[model samples]
Target chain A: MSCRIGMDVGGTNVVTGLFDSEGRLLRRSKVRTIKLSSCELIQQLAGQCKEILAAEGVRESELEAVGIGLPGFIQSESGVVSSANLPFNDVPVATRLQQLLGVPVAVENDVKMVVYGEYLHGAGKGYSHVLGLTIGTGMASAWVSDGRLHEGAGGLAGEIGHISFPDISYMCGCGMKGCLETVASTAGIARQARDGLKAGWVGLLAERFPPEIRDELTSHDVWQAYLDGDAFAGQVFQRTANWLSRVLVPSIALLSPDVIIVGGGVAAAGDIFFDSLRSYVSASLHPLYRERLRIVPPSLGDDGGLYGSAEFALKSRKIGLRI
Target chain B: MSCRIGMDVGGTNVVTGLFDSEGRLLRRSKVRTIKLSSCELIQQLAGQCKEILAAEGVRESELEAVGIGLPGFIQSESGVVSSANLPFNDVPVATRLQQLLGVPVAVENDVKMVVYGEYLHGAGKGYSHVLGLTIGTGMASAWVSDGRLHEGAGGLAGEIGHISFPDISYMCGCGMKGCLETVASTAGIARQARDGLKAGWVGLLAERFPPEIRDELTSHDVWQAYLDGDAFAGQVFQRTANWLSRVLVPSIALLSPDVIIVGGGVAAAGDIFFDSLRSYVSASLHPLYRERLRIVPPSLGDDGGLYGSAEFALKSRKIGLRI
Candidate 1:
């Protein structure tokens, strides 16, 4: 049985997994994503592939293909694009990997890969039309209809985070003011918490976080405070939910997907985030749609991206071999 | 050469067209859509089909199939569903039409048909991922990706009009408060103008439309006053554009279509409506997407729905014959 290597490349770490044709994860490895040149990063990734193969006692010839998922605007056809956080721009990722590994390689946006992974093997398994939202440091979404990803005209589809929230005035990293990301993301939550504290808004946060640590309060801290029943934290969380619902409601209206799978750190807050969100979404949805729509958390959790990359590689290899 | 019949059934009219295999309209006919029973509406549509066929001198034997586009939540496979504006609920449109016309019948949502028409023969011809927005009495949108319509799980997709706008408090016809339709549709615009007039907000509307006519002022009157350089009318139009941009900017970020095709009576206001809308949408978009996206008017105008219905019939017929 042929195996493939799937890699999820992020700003902080590179996660690689080995899986067989049926998408069973045989082995896995990870390495820190150091600030290196594009060529160096590619070399490190190839080295990790070799290390995994050696650990598994498999030869390069026995592998079918490799797939990589990373952050960026991906030109899927050429497997090249640029991202602000990455070390390189216009990097031909698939070509470079194929040259080094002597196998076909597939590359796609990381979030899209995660969505594909969920669609193939996780919560989205049985749904033909799936919408996946990942809310972490930033927000991103991907759409899969009829079992294929809708990458859009420029492969920039599903950038839900950058949607302008005309009511807000926060400047976003994407150079736009009042983007949904500024108000709905993990970073956004943390920023709001910090600003509220600075403004002398009294809440349970004062008791939960002392003076020294208060300055470094993150979204996790805010979430913990909310869990501890802090009114301010609860309000912040509610605002995020409101912003998310504003975008999600319209999205549901526009896409009408069978399932909406939400993942990432914020979703890990569990019922604290989802319960109210589900109610808000359901209450706001048209009667015709509210009863049938499913909003749930991703089952695969963090590994979804890796599994998706592997599945994509296997699918692409099969097609390549068929051709 | 085989011909086909296509029908666009709306709340006010039933338009029928005869088209050859190439999607060219050979002949057309229309009849007023009185508030008939479902059976009567079906009979009227069937009668119009026969009238068009006779006018074109095309025999039923030479026709491939018939396609109908109407407003409703469609179960495309069964071609049965309900809509708020339609006189009947759970109407078996295709089954009834097939029985009456003695031919294969395919039915779909009217907006989806218009998008398909635009995709096939209008301004959306060259784009693989197309988004069509029709702003008339209400707002609706449809998406075409990879040459196929993305009909969501329940065919309730593209109902952007019902998306809640939390910032607004206006009640919508859909039994929801602050839906986008309350602020962005033709009715929404008219309501805002009427409300502003009632609130005694002084504007050129008072002069353009005296007290008697003020009570009957429509969206067209608002548009006319805006064109005639009324500040309040312009602000009203700008507010509508703002609300539209709020929804559309996010849609652009999420869908990233090649072009956004705007149609319907509101769009017929020409550059008076589009120029400002285009500027607002552009100014609000992330730089990554703003440069590549095009928002333009539909080339086929009102006939887009008819052509789309006809084209859908031809395509469905070919597939049916293949099966």
Candidate 2:
């Protein structure tokens, strides 16, 4: 059994799992992504790995390889840090992990790995063309063409969220004005709702809201409020759906993928986001393609990135081991 | 020499050229595409092929393969008839062409051939990621990833013009509403300009026009007028430039290809198009990618489609002879 470890490195939590050849997860563990300096973060991750091994009752020699999936631009070849999400700059992640764990390591942008999983075993399975989109505080996408993941030149192929979109006027973190993220992301929705509430505008905002809660409203909370029948929340979701569909419909027409796997925390809004998006996308599509574009929820859900990481590690490893 | 013949089938003209192993265009010939039934067109094309062979003093056995490039979708494996521009309705183009021409024939979509040319011998050479865009009567894009032109699951990738966008006020030829072509194509520009002139809007158009040509205008004439520094022409070019850049900036940021080559008649706007598009794209991009994207002209020029057709045919042969 050539078992490997896969980890999704998030700001607050880190989830690691040992997976086998057939995509079955053998063992899993979770830990905090402890706040620390550059050297200390790596040390903490190393400790977590040991903990996972101990908890799984597996020998160190049993582990074949390790794959870590993180957010941002990943230098796949050298495994250096190119994205802004991680603390370390230009850190040789795979090399350091290989030395620490005594096994080969593969690192990739988290969502990119998720896209791989989606195409292989999730909603995108059996399709040679797919666009896996993650809609959270930010937006990002990955491309699968002809049953192969497309890692574009310079590894920046699926950075759709950072690009400027039409009719948007705000600046994005990447310094671009009116990026897709500014209009369609969860953050965009929450912010719009928050502003509307702050202005005392007539909407379905709960008047008995906590003061602290009013200061920091997330898309999650907004969705909850909408389900509670908040008109503003519904309007915000509709706007987000419409705007996102503007980009997505065109993308689908251009790529004509077999499926679109929508992921991320925002997708949890479910029908609120999907209904409007589907309708708008259909209404906007060229007549020749309106009936053919298919959009669906990601089957792998939150663990998509972790599964993809495991798949990548398994494919790249040459040794046999366990968790 | 085992030379191959590459044919680019257009609505009006059918161009056939012989290509050697070294990428040299050995001989060339052309004939009108007989606007007739599917069988008659095939007969006429076969006759044209025979004429070209006899005129070039080449023997039948010397030819290795025949490749045809058309302006619509191609199921290269089955040689399905998918072209909207041609009169043929669901005909077996590759098999019939092979039988008529008495050689191995491979048929491919036109843009596929264009991207192939860029990959093998044009601006896209040595790069693993490339996008070829044409802004003529309609917009079209081709994507080449990792040395291969990516065809989506349904052989429908890279159809950018058909992507639904923000154009809610106009109708597209595809019968879809809000498609990108409604605003970003040469036809779009001409339509806007012609409308402007007919409405008797005050500008340099009236000053430069001879009353006879004021209202009935074309995009090409607008370019020539812009070159002459007509006031209305200046505004026309500026508006068109903005539209072109608006589409390009976000596209480049999202896809992040190694190179984006602009082609088609509207692309010949040269600096009139390139200069503004550069500034606009830079302004539209995230700071991280401001310096990453490169915009260039098509090196293969009008011949790019021809060369791309040759490469696509040769490559398709490796996948399977098809016929």
Question: Model 1: per-residue lDDT, tens digit, B189-308?
Answer: 888998898888676787766667777888889888888888888888777776777668778878899999988767777776787788888887788788897889999867898889
Q: What is the TM-score of chain A, computed separately for every candidate?
A: 0.95, 0.91
lDDT by residue (A1-323, candidate 2, tens digit) is 55678888877778888776567887777777656666777777777777777787777887777888888777766788655666778888778878898888888888888888888778888877888888886788888776566666676767778767557887777765778787678778777777777777564465635456776777777888889888878878888887677557657655677788888877778998888878888776554455567778899766777788877776656333122
Candidate 2 displacement at residue B133 in angstroms:
1.2
Residues B169-288 of candidate 2: C-alpha lDDT, one tens digit per residue: 677777766666766677777777776777786655555554587556678787887887766766665666676665565456556788888777777888877776677777767765
Residue runs of model 2 more than 4 Å from their true location after superposition: A210-213, A317-323, B164-168, B207-215
Model 1: what TM-score? 0.95
Worst 10 residues of 2 chain B by lDDT: B245-254
* Span of ten consecutive residues with least summed lDDT in model 1 chain B: B314-323
Model 2 lDDT at residue A215 = 62
